[model samples]
Target: MKNALKEIILAAATAAHQKGIFPSSDFCEVVLEEPKADSHGDLSTNMAMQMAKTQRMSPRKIAETLIDHLDDTRGLIDRTEIAGPGFINFFIRPSAWYPVLAAIHEQDDQYGRCDLGKGTRIQIEFVSSNPTGPLHVGHGRGGAVGDSTANILSFCGFDVQKEYYINDSGRQIQTLGMSVYLRGKELLGETVDFPDTCYQGDYIRDLAGELLEREGRELFDKSEAETIMPCARYAAEKITEGMRADLVDFGVTFDQWFSEQSLYDSGKVAGDIRDFKEKGLIYEKDGALWFKTSDYGDEKDRVVVRQNGQTTYFASDITYHKDKFERGFQKVIDVWGADHHGYIPRMKAAVVASGYDRDQFNVLLVQLVNLLRAGQPVAMSTRAGEFVTLSDVVKEVGRDAARFIFLTRHYESSLDFDLELAKQKTNDNPVYYVQYVHARISSIHRKAGSDGLDVSGFAPSDLSALETREDIVLIKALARYPEAVETAGALREPHRITYYLMTLSAAFHTYYNRHRVLCEDDLKLTRARLYLISAVQKVIRNGLALLGVSAPDAM
Candidate 1:
């Protein structure tokens, strides 16, 4: 519908230009948007206001001129009016929305998809948690945001590749190995002092036990120094396996599980440093190789390699991004935790210094998630190994509720995930509320079938019987689905879909309360309402699918 309105505005502008109302046909892009109130109009545009300076006319006069030249021969619009400050308001005929229902039926699951991306090769790397520990609630929020964003962009015609960068080669992995090895020593009746900085999760003990069962007491025969690397390797593998299972249970599957170690092994990190040196972006300062990131907007220069010759994490990340661009990805989006917000400037500087356009790289910062139960904060400490894992949240609340609640707010804002509210079956729980709308429509369809109504044969003509105010409002709400999806996808924000679903669901619930769908005296109206609700069901299902939530026929 937004596209249709844009086309109408373009046609009106062209006609006015052809009639010499304006000096030339060249004009800025037409921007149409929904009005705040239904009384204003179905859609509003500021095209005339934008063109007023170019035409040397008042905005009001330009708006009137454009409206005069508008072609509504097909009755697509009921009327056009000029409002305050020369804004053109277009009121679409109620019957013009009937094709939206037909489109819903024809497209089914593919109704809200748009070609806004034009098949751009985009890679989104998110939830790239280190393999040293299990993912916590914060990581879970990242997963939901990343996965939903990927799904939305894919539906919008972008070739999106979801990736998880494993921080497997770091001090954390060595700490994980030490933790497991010390636990194994304890299992072997040896008194070993565990460091306070080592991983203390129960999963470490489980890994040690598994290692004992597989490698046996022979591992104990070797010195602790000799066993450290093996222990770390086994622990990382086991932890990564558990992480994979947890993400799968949460309905997130990545197209690639990129290993950070591979970058160093492939000499990409060194190659990146050499490239920066050749470009004069790298300089040696105080026995360390530094990148002049401050020249590209960073607050200060950053050390890429230490005096001891070991590269910092920043070096690996720069090469990783370079490798992404080299892999034919036109756009790269990195989903990082809010704590990494300060790291964005340096990373963007590296991308720009590496000869890529600044716009080609984007970083989405996902704020922390605070888990609550009945209004009290749930205690969690990642370092103490006492944090609530992602699997725990999924177990407490179903995946559908978890994913929906995770996306209820934008990723930039901190989320307070209430386990109790998420589990509720009432309207307070948005996932349940939206699912119930779908279920209610399914029930109506079944009831109509039981009454010997052939709802499947209902044609566009039957929709003429939908003349009530609530009927028109419901159709209008349904019409916003595609626009909502396109906007959300283009803006790289998945929360918009959740907002749209909640609005549509509320509208449907209100209409159901005030109206009767199965009118025995007015069979035509009943069939029309049935078709309307069916379209609503289809849209709800489609939106929920994009969020990776289940839309059940029955709650």
Candidate 2:
């Protein structure tokens, strides 16, 4: 529908130019909208207001000129009125919306699919939690947002690769190993003082038990120097296994699990630092090696390697971005928590320092989610291992509800995840609302064949008979899906889809409450209405699928 409006607006522009209203054809991108009240108009555009200053005429005159040229609309437009401040409000005919039902039926699940992306290669890296502990609810939000965003962009024809950056070469992995080893030593009746650096989760105890069952207690009793690295490796594997299972159960699968350790093992980090050094981007000061990130946009120079001979996390990050660009992605998007907002500038500086276009790198900051149980906040302390894991939420509310609730808001906004609200099966829960629409449509279809309706000879009657205001309302809502999908894909926002689903479901429920389809008043009209509802069912299913939420026919 947005594309259709653009076409109409451009034609209006041509008509205005022919009347000597403008010298050039370039005009502002006019906004096409639907008024809040049903009495206003079906669709409205502010083209006249945008052209007023350029054409040096009153907006009313420009609106009249454009409406005069709108003569060739062939009754698709019922009437045109000049609204406030010279806005052209188009009251479209029922025919204009009726064809949308046919289009939806013909297209089925492919209704809103588009090619705006033109197959541009883009990579989105997110939920790259360290393989040191189980993934908590914080990681759940990131997973939902990232996965749904990728699904939307892909549906719009972008070549997108969802990736997870595994931080395996870090101190956290060592801490996980120490945690497991200390727990195992305790099990072996050995006196041990567990450090604050060790992991405190009960999952660490399970991993230690498994390791002891296989390798015995002698492994932990070995020299600390010989034991720590192996313990870290084992703990990393155990944690990563759990994370992979959790993500998979949550309906997310990354195309790539990139490793930070691989960057060091492959010598890519050393090579990148050496190249930056040769480019005079690196220097030594105060016995520390630093990158001149300030030259790009950072507030100060960042130390790549300390005098203690250990490279900082930022040093390895430079190599990671370099690796992503090396893989031929035109753009790299990193989804990080809002706490890491200050890190974006330096990451962009590293990309520029590595001789890549700074604009090609983008950091999307996902604001934190505050988990609430009942009406109170759920306090969590990671050090104490009292955090709610993503799996815990999934197990409690089910995966579909979890994904839907997590994606119900914009990623940049702080999300208040209320456990009480999420568990509800009523109208307050948006997921159930959409699923109920699907189930209702399915029930209508089931009754059609049993009502002695001929299945083979049946064809959807002309939608011109769909004249009720509620019927047209549902048709218009279905027609606006492509526009919603395109806007969401272009903006990289999944919440738009959630908003659309809620509106679409509202229209469906409204129509369902007022009309009876299985009655004998008009069987042909009954089939037509059922066909329209069937199309709605398909759309709801497809939209929910994109968000990784299920649409059950029976539920």
Candidate 3:
């Protein structure tokens, strides 16, 4: 549909060129928009207004000329109107949209797919939660956003890589080890005080039990420095295992689990710092190695290495990004929590300093998620090991319900995920609303098959014969699916798919309530209606699949 729209605009431009008028190619970016109110038309574009300055004419005149020159595709486009301020609104015929049902039937699950990306290599790094504790609701939000985003990109024809950057070389892992060790000691009847910095989740006890089973009492009684590192290593591994299980249950997988420790082991961090020093981009100030990030529009010069000779998180990030680019990814998308919002500029500056185009990198700051139970906020305390873990949420609500609820809101907005609301089987839970449509469609197909009708190799012609208004609405919504997918994928906003699925399912349910697809007398119409409804069902299924949500044929 995007390509179709582009062809229409380009044809109009070519006509203006033939008329010895400066043909407007710049209208390419002129917002080709869908009318907010359905009464306006099927589709609208502001190409004329965008060309007004170049054409040396008012937008209305330019629209009139362009509309006159638009090529006719049979009767697909009934007419093109130049509305207020040169808005070109195209009124496409019913037959034009009717083909979309056939197209869906023909293409099946691959209807909305495109080759726009052309297999460009891309890497999306997201949800690299620390191994110190189990993933919370905040981490769940990141998981859904990152997984769905990568899924959307993959559907759009990119050779996409999903990555998780493990912060295994950090202080947090050590704190986790100490927490587990202390819990183990307490279990052994030793009065051990838990450190304030240690992870205080009940999962720590589980990790401790594993350590006890592995190393026994000898390692437990070892000296603090010797015991802490190995214990931390064990704890980190255990916690990361839990993270993996949780994500697997949530339906996300990573192509790579990049270790921060590798950067240090391979001397990439030192090499990057040395390279920056050679380029005069680094300087020693008050015993710290400072990178000239301020020169690249950052707020201030940032320390890559502190006065104590230890590299900061920023240094590790610099080498990691450098490694990402060197891996030959044409584009890199990093999904960071919103609290790390300030880190965006410095990372981009480092990429620029490393001599890479800034456009190649994108940082998406997922705002946050505040979990609620019934209608009140759920209090969480990591120290007491009493927080609502992501796994807990999954157990409370099934994976499909959990994922659909998490994705119901945009990633950039704070989410108020309510346990009770998400668990509902009604329309309040959009997962069910969308799935019900799929199941209903499936039921219709089953009925069609049982009635001895040959559904295979069936072709739908004369869609006008199916005259229910609900049928038209369903066809219209299905027709808009390709455009919806294009918009959602282009904008990297998966929430649009959620919204679209809801609207599509609503149309199906409304039609189901008002109209009947199965009848003994109107067998041909029933079959045609089933064909139409089943196509819509496939679209809904595909859309849910893109969001990593399930569309069950039953319940």
Off by over 4 Å in 2: 19-26, 455-461
The total number of steric clashes, by the backbone 3 Å criterion, in model 2 comes to: 0
CA error at residue 498 for candidate 3, angstroms: 0.8
Q: RMSD to the native, candidate 3?
A: 2.6
Better of 1 and 2 by TM-score: 2
lDDT of 1 at 140: 90
lDDT of 2: 0.86
Residue pairs with colliding backbones in model 3 are 200-385, 201-385
Off by over 4 Å in 1: 17-28
- Candidate with more favorable, higher TM-score: 1 or 3: 1
The candidate scoring highest on lDDT is: 1
Residue-wise C-alpha lDDT for candidate 2, range 369-388, written one tens digit per residue: 89998879999999998899
**What's model 1's lDDT at 50?**
93
Q: Quick one: ranking by lDDT, best first?
A: 1, 2, 3
Candidate 3 wrongly placed segments (more than 4 Å) = 1-32, 37-39, 46-73, 79-82, 85-88, 451-457
After superposition on all C-alphas, the RMSD of every candidate to the true structure, in Å, is 1.9, 1.7, 2.6
Worst 10 residues of 2 by lDDT: 454-463
